[model samples]
Target: MSFIPRRPPRHLLRLLVLLAVAALLYFYSAPVFNAAARSLIRVDAPAPADVVIALGGDARCMRERRAAEIFNRGLARHVIVSGVPYAWGVHTGDAAKRYVESLGVPAERITVLRDAWNTRREAMDVNELMRAQGWNRAILVTSPFHSRRAHYTFRRYAAEYTFISMPLEPEPPEWQPERWWSRRGDLGITVREYLSWINTLAGGWR
Candidate 1:
């Protein structure tokens, strides 16, 4: 064969492609991810929803309680709280399960799913439960800032569930963050939500 000089290495081309993808992932998904997260963080009541399905803990005990108040007033007849009182006992679902039942939701009207280990797990559990029960419409209950991620994840996984957003209003000035732009959380909740929002926008989640 005639002496042929080696072609330029394809490594450079691969690097360029990698950089391009990174840039796109950051540019497109970053803003949307953050913006959507903030929207979730700031939304106390962006709109109406059917059932304020509490995400457990303070979200259920406090802010979500407000939303549940509306539900108790006949806004919706069904509310689903995902937790297993009989299994994990009080740590996960027991308190919430009792709380909802105390809200006048007859045992039959309230559906308790007690198996979620995290919000994503809870979302998936609730999704499956809703489908099984044929519950097509719902309003997810989580902290004001967390509502976005929870709502988004639940909506994404469930796919067919019709949902309205109802966030728990952040506590008064005492607990409020120093700035309006502060992310949402109770000890790591804000950070966790921020990451989750990012994952969803990028469509890179498992």
Candidate 2:
């Protein structure tokens, strides 16, 4: 007598398909997630402005470098470096000023604001500076991951002036947005920026 073979149960077949789909997503989701992460960045086209403000936090000085490039291009008449003191006691604002000046921006054209401990304070202080200087348009230079929130915060605090965001593009090798999750430092930066953005959206910008 010949034995008949039975097909697998419907529930078991469905479970197997679900597991396969989950595994596929787990392995192939990085690129999709990276694109989603990158959506937070906002870079405006280069345009003439009264001043370029470089928000400090980068030990690599990427923000200052971008500010200098904008100044050298004659897009901005002045450069403002805003930062708090570093852990070692040197004010990042002062350091940024020196760095930008070295890149051919005249020392007389650079102003350093060293008291702002965060982006909100920086916006407030820079607003005061812009008011005193009679500057109506400004460009904000910061890390790519920080551009969106930085622009939002500045607009919220300094609505009187036109603020353009110019995040560092072609980001440095150490902070490439693509495959950010593969590096610990890049992952931390990405995560922190997202959290900060959420906080900003929640009116937590203090």
Choose the strongest candidate by lDDT.
2
Candidate 1 lDDT at 49 equals 45
TM-score per candidate, chains pooled: 0.64, 0.86
Query: Per-residue error at 116 for model 1, in Å?
Result: 1.8
Candidate 2's C-alpha runs over 4 A off are 1-17, 20-24, 87-89
**C-alpha displacement of 7 in model 1, angstroms?**
45
- Show where candidate 1 strays beyond 4 Å: 1-37, 42-50, 84-91, 173-189, 199-206
lDDT of 2: 0.87
lDDT value for model 1: 0.63
lDDT of 2 by residue, 72-114 (tens): 9999999998777777867877887889999999999999998
